[model samples]
Target: MKKQQFVCTSMIPYPSGNLHMGHIRNYTINDVICRKMGIKMFMGWDSFGLPAENFSISKKKTPKLCVKKNIKSMKKQFVDMGYDIVWNKEINTCNRNFYKITQFIFCKLYKCKYIYRGKCISYWDKKDKTTLSKEQIIKGRGWRSGSKVVKRFTKSYFVNLKNSFLKSIIKDIKLSNWPETIKKKQINWIGEEKGYVIKEYHLFFNNIKPFNSLVFSFNNLVLIKKLTKVKKQLNNIISNKNIFYKRNDFIYFVGYKIVYKKKLPVFISDNINFKEFYHPFVLNPFSNIRFKRKMKRKILLNLMFEKGFNTNEIFFKRKTTYKILDWNISRQRYWGTPIPTIVCKNCGVYQERLKNLPVNIKKVKLNNNSDIIKVEKTVINCHKCNCLSYRETDTLDTFFDSSWYFLHYFCKDIRKSKPLDIYIGGEEHSILHLLYSRIIIKILNKIKIVNFKNPFNTLIIQGVILNYSYYYFKNGVKNWIRKINKPKKEIKIYKKLTKMSKSKKNGINPYKYIKRFGVDTLRMYILFIAPINKNFIWNENKIIGCYRFINKVLEFFRNKKNYYYHHHLKYNKFIIKKIEEDINLCYKNFKFNILVSKIMTEFKILKKHNIKNNNVLEKFLNNLYPICPFLVKSINNNFKCQL
Candidate 1:
């Protein structure tokens, strides 16, 4: 019989140098599962993007140097914990070889027209003179500079996900073993709208041919000619993201009647602007194509609004659609995957040739963004015009780097990789990160980069780690208390037990707990405290209980006197069979807390039975390895703990 093989994956840490409780809980869960299941696991670094750049700036050093230092510290911490994961097969996002693959995928998508240039509203920090991500904004102000964030219009790249593809995502995600809440988040973000709202007068709509693209009561051809001359008067009325159906807010335009079939181009106003349109098309919410006749352009604008325009009644039907916007993947930051694009004055936007895969990013000072060049080459010429062209300085949003990162692990045979057996990460990624990865994987499948569809078969979202931070308001500004000496009641009003974050100054170092108690005790305590998915506190008082349990287990393994030269073959089978059943049930239900409780109970039963068999000992030790590896390591090393 062929042996079943399993591979486990964990979310790569951002390599920010500060490994806090959140990282410990997440990686500990991953390590425990890998060890318990006998699955081979791989480690990688999510080394690109903002956090490292921010840290480097604060320390007055370069980003590459800072990231290199952090990776060394973090790897040692992982080694100290004895993860037994494959460190040699590690991949880093910022590495040239790794990002080469990332750029290749982007260029491929760009060639296929899945990627395009579009305009988006970006948040500009006036004080810092930089772009701030949605996360970097605290309320309406920049978190770093405390500058009020204002929207700036900029041309950017977008991965054009047609509406049809989005609906498929809505249907296909049900196959994965993800939390229902996470699934709902992706669906809601896509913003699928079902059926349509039409009015009674809209029934003038039987056969709709809506080719006209102008504000009419005016002739279609004449309106077009007149609009060229009248553009200045209608400058503010151009369609943008803000245009929606409300009389004052609406800038009426004739858009295609979006239907399942190629319905005729009908008169579709985007919900309320007939006051200036001079037509009573707003007589219903969404009208059926019914225009009486054409009037001259001069008379149409002068028509009185008091003459017409009234909604008779509402209408409804069962329909399906998606309102999802294309993905915006442009960032103004330096530490990210450089967008593999160039623009020329004559030829417009051009994708870099695939043979020249990575348009290498030249690292520069944090404040300086001008004259970003490709590798050592100072000037790159456009393929079409052969004239001096500019490289796209805007690096991709960091999320793009992570989108297909897991696939890089199996890049040699992405198709054979099937789907990642298990993927583990925090619930905070349920929206942006998970959705982007899933969609990018689908795009890969569409482009035949990967044969399999789903990126991960099982997704485990760990709950947030909550902790208390004492703080008080000072002159209308909130300040976190560095030293806590006051009584609980005195600080009660100011004490906040929120998710452990560096911003909140509540994140505790895991090594502190690891030093007091061993690594095994720390890992066991986290699982023993509550279910892995539950949001719980990092309470220090409960550490002693786990510490004592580890010491007891360590003593049993070391004492040779506890072993006997007796063989109870039949009794050993009975004990092993029962233990296997319990372990299976625990894993099946993800009841890790119960496994530790049951192990404690089983020790009493083992002492009572006095069963002395190596097979029984091996069975118990193997199952217990996840919770107490230090004790089990001796048995594994010294021939399976002889009875």
Candidate 2:
């Protein structure tokens, strides 16, 4: 008979930096599942994108070097945690094979007419001279360089995902096994607004030659047509920009629909006579804007409800756009994978090919590549096209590296294969990264590059490692603070406002916690103190309680003189029934607290009676092997209880 087969995968983290406690929690839970379930589990690295490149640029190191260092550190941490990871399938997106496939998929999408070129208006860093994604754009003058960013537009490429093909999958896919919060978030990210809003506007055209050059900014920049005949009437009402104006002589009304990214525009009629040119569609609660034209580049993106339109209207009905913004995959940063493209002088256009990608490091000179070309990393125009267009140098979005990493594992063992199994990660990625991964999978599958119909059969999004900052005021000014002085704060104790990260210095390191307290103590304390997803403060005193509990169990085992019938016989069946019920509940909930509680209750009952049945005790110990493996193994090895 064939052995049972099971496939499991962990969402690879970008080697951004050191792994945090939250990351440890994510991997630890997965490791436990893999070990207990007795299945094949795989691990890989998202060793590509911005974090690696950014670190390399900052440290003046190569991205390959940075990733190597980070991977070494992360691997050591995982080993220490006792994770059974299949490291042979480890992947790095920076590799030619990985990105070669990514670019090939891009070509396939392009061939299918799902790819197009357009403009992206945003802050252009004069020093670094690149467009910044929303995350990379700081609230200062410039995120990378100190120079102020200016509003500049660039011609770029985009994948056209606004179709029923992608939309239908989302509508049809059952999220029953997934977390409800994540499902709701993914639904929101898809931005589906059910009913359509319709509006009609009357204006004379320059020559009535059927104007078709109209484009709308879903992020709120509207383009009005410049008509020759209606120029004066339009000029009196509408500015050179898309802003609105009202006149006493004549009245103008505008109408449009707020459509989801994947849906066609129906109609959303909002009649404004003389108000500002801003449409109600632009400002929404979730919407934020960073004006490329602003001098200081304030993150003035938050909606205040007083802007131009009602927050309800904007959020309830989002602007729908069939036109896609260009993929601004260019950056002038010091360190990043060079966009593989060359410009042709005769044709004055750019060309990119997959086979020639991931420029040979040894063949080209880095200094010369940096000095003459202004933009350090770049794509090239096709040498065959003879065009003067420069290559787009911006690297792929770092999120792109992590998005389909789980899929890669399925095919990692094969010479050239596809993804296997499911994606397991924190709840945080559901919005941007996970959504994009779904789109990427669909596009890849549609192109017939991979055989798999769905990227991941199952998705398990774990919760954050619930923790709280421990601080105490000194000098009577409420300023000076220390972590050790405070008591443990449970997630139920205090509501925190910020996420824990290295930059915040908000969490205690597990290494320090373990060194001070035993591993079992820390483990027991963490689970008993709070629910898995909520935050709690780390306190040594609480950990001491766990240590005491373990000591109590050990003492009970060691002190017994005889194991025959010294304890009570009446409650054996009743206690066993209760323990079994708790185990069933634990199987259903997968909750640590409930399992621990049941174990503790059983221990208390066993201790109340003299050491009675060894067989009963052995069964109890085996049941706890999932949570506290080390202690159970230690007891079995030393005592050798006869069942």
Candidate 3:
């Protein structure tokens, strides 16, 4: 009988630098699962991204060189940790052969009418000179450059997401065995708003369009004619009612009036100094705020219709508008998958033929002034018209590189088969990467490229490792201050335990821990810290505890003279049963911490009982192999014991 097929995968990390504690935790969890289940595992680098480009620019080297150096270092680290990954199946998104598949998928999507070009407003960072995704923008600023982001309209390619498609995605999400928190986040990200769009008399105030203008009620017309004098009058009227304080910047109004053959109260309020309103005024009929005496828009529309008013001219039903926008796959940077499209003056825009795929990134020297558009090799002859044309200089977004990587892992020969059985990634990508991957798989399924709709049967979003981040304020600007050993009274240093990241300089390098305590000890320490899904603070003392446990196990196994055979053993039976129960529990709920604790307890019990049965000892070693493979291998090799 054929062995059951099981494939496990994880998010390919960007080769920005060395792996950190978070990377260790994520990969270790998946490695342990795959080993315990006896499944196939594939590992690769998400090597193409802005971080690599920035590093290349800073080092005055090509992105290829930078990526090669970083991947070598990172791969060594993974090997040192004894990850049970199939080295032969490694993939790098930056590789021409691998990206050929990505570009091929892009052409498929284009042919399916899921891809289009349009002018879109994007967050542009002037300092970095690149468009930033919503995820890359932090609190209205660029994440990398810390520059203020401004809106700019640019011609770009987008992946169209229809309302029906979104509903289908959401529907499929409910059927999957994903975390409730992640499901809810995807729902919110694809925000669906339902309401009617009623037309209002614009009154031609401040050049506002009069006909077909959206309004919540007819009373909004009164504010249109405001000469700035009407605002003061409304403010005074509200203040006289003792509803608002005089010192307040503005007062709220609930004025009722008749306009355009309808009598309804139009909710108006001052825009200045009002924390509640995001705009100058809140005018949506479906707004959360409700006036005590105001009638609903639906009721007012019915009354106007009864009065023989032309409903089409005065009001219309609202169309569903989704909050989630189409994905902008265009990026103005090097060190990414080049978009596989060519623009010809005679033939218009045309996707490169599959035979000419990959649109391999040309090797170009790096400089502070490097621009993809200025690169000479970017210009290419059109595949359709055979005329001089330019290749799409902009590279595909990094998210595109990751969106379908799991599927590629299962498609070694591009066969139609089920997707991977398990996927492990960070919760930070719950909305962006996970959602995009699911959508891409569905599209591929519709196009008959794949047999499955979902890529992974199960997804595990690992919790982030966090450390205490220290920073100081300098000249009214917050500066990241590292290496704070002791608090200084005059400096007013601030610190908070947050997610480990390179920008904050709070990430703990896994190499340090690996070198100091050995990979097995570091791995056990991370697994033993807390539950896999919860955040825990980094502590050196706990690492030492793990080191001691490993040494104790080593010492216990080395003394072969102390061993004795116990034929009838009640304690060994109990220990074996307990280990089985812990293994089951770990597989059931991903409670690796609990499993590690139980294993330690079992070791202590074995020592206390002085159990010397070889069969029992081998059973224990097999159970421990997944978590501490290197240590177990060393012990077995030295003692000629089978694990």
Candidate 4:
């Protein structure tokens, strides 16, 4: 029988700069998995993103050039680390041919009515003058610019998720082998809340007309200053008792009071974090109360009855609405796949013909003033009307490029019919990239572009690598201080272990570690440091320990005569059985940390018995090969033994 096909992939890293310890840890975990499983792996770069654009702008180079340079450097590091990747199957999103396929997929989505143009509220970064996806927003600020992000109604293309597609996606999540934590996060993100859609009526206060509104109880009422007309009317009704406040850091509490048969108060406080009601004036029923859903429903029903509404007249049936918004894949950036669309005044929006695709981005010089859409070279005649039309200026979001890349690994012909067997990525992408990819795959399956409904059969989310970060506050400004740099004069210093990030200046360079210790030693040290799915704190002393362990292993092999033991020894069978059991368990659960510990235990047993059986030693070396390939290869060559 043919061997079962297996494919593995990791989240492609953006070529913004050097590969850090975080990148090393992510790739190494996947590498070990693929090696142990005896499967070929495909790797690539997420070459098109805001970071590459920012880096290019700072360095006075084109984004393409910057990405190319960084990928070259990073690929060398991967090679040096002995990653068993199929370079021929490798893909870079920045490649025109690759993005051409991306554009083709977009066109397919467009034709299927999955893509549409609409105005929606999205996170807008004023400094970058671009729109950000919910995933791109960090703490209500732009991830790249660190500028405060604000809600803006922008006209852009959106993927339609308000349909049975969502139900299908949710259903597939239940059937997949994804981690329960990630599955729960995606379910929460989909935010399918079942609530009643009650009929609402307007009530007048102080001769002011109240529009369609809902009623709920509130202690205090406040109005946003932006609603000048409403504020003025409210001021007259309350006799200037209304408190007004302006805050950029917190949500504004715009409250209102209405009378339906009886007076009812509604407040929109920041503390009310539940989904907004359908009516403009509403209150969170769960806020300020620790009641169960059934109790809350009873209280709401009682309130409706008190408002002179019969039980039959009140609409109490449950309805569902997703908190997750439709994906907005339009970006006003230079270093991304150009959205393959054209707009003509005489004609409507049209997708570029497949034959004319790629719509090469290299032709346009991505400077501050150069707009590719308006350029004469990019303008084309409408296929039907022959009227001149400009290409879409907005490039596709980087997430769009990533969503279907795993499929490309197996579907090289695009007409072929296979999905990736496994996909490994960071937990942070659970809701964003993972969800988007699933949606895209479902759409593709519907359109008969591929056979698979889900892209990956198995998913692995590796934990983040964190390092100790030190900061000092001076004159109300917090400065990131290096650990080596001691504060002077008894200044209060704070230290915390946070995710290794370039912006925080807390990232450890893997190259530096590799230079001090060999690449195999560094790889082994990282895998041994923590469980694959748990956050690990980087420790320098651990690096020294790993280096010492490598040296000890080399010394043992060199002095094998003194440590040799016969194969019939009683302890030999125990050591072999223990190693076999541990290795099997490690491969089954991807518990690399436990595997390393078990291997160390076996090493202790070996030294105690002085085991010198070539067969048993070869089995031990073979198991270790996946973790430290270079070290194992060297040992096999020097010892003249086949492992």
- Indicate whether candidate 1 or candidate 3 has the larger TM-score: 3
| TM-score, per-candidate, Cα-based | 0.76, 0.68, 0.81, 0.83
- Candidate 3: list runs displaced more than 4 Å: 1-4, 197-315, 368-377, 383-387, 413-417, 472-481, 484-494, 561-566, 569-572
Full-model lDDT, candidate 3: 0.71
lDDT of 2 by residue, 1-643 (tens): 2322467667777675566666666665565556556664577677765445545666656668778888888788777655667777677776767766555555556667666545545457665556654334554355334445555556545556553653564663444345667667666545443322221111111111222112122222221121111323434534554434333222222222223322211111111111233332222111121122221111221111123222234322323322112234445443444444444557543335555654532222234234222234344444775443566555555555555666566564222455445456766666556666766666666776666555566676665654454333333212212344443543222234344554334645667766775556556665666656555544556678777888788778777634545354656677676786886577445576676778888888778765377667877776665556667667766676643
Best by TM-score: 4
Runs of candidate 4 exceeding 4 Å displacement: 1-4, 198-228, 231-261, 266-317, 362-377, 470-496, 561-572
Ranking, lDDT, top scorer first: 4, 3, 1, 2
Q: Candidate 2: where are CA atoms >4 Å away?
A: 1-5, 122-151, 173-176, 194-392, 413-422, 451-454, 465-497, 535-541, 557-571, 610-615, 640-643
Please give the distance, in angstroms, between residue 452's alpha carbon in candidate 1 and its true position after superposition: 1.9
lDDT for each residue of candidate 1 in 504-606, tens digit (9 for 90 to 100) = 6788888898888978888888888888888998889998998887776566656634564557634455555786788768876667888877777666555
Give the candidates in order of TM-score, highest first. Answer: 4, 3, 1, 2
| TM-score of candidate 3 against the unseen true structure | 0.81
User: Is candidate 1 or 4 superior in TM-score?
Assistant: 4
Encode model 4's per-residue lDDT on 55-162: one tens digit a residue: 777776777778888888888888888898888778899898899999999998898888987654567887677898876787777877667787666778888775
Model 2, residue 475: distance off in Å is 28
Clashes of each: 5, 40, 2, 1
Worst 10 residues of 3 by lDDT: 201-210
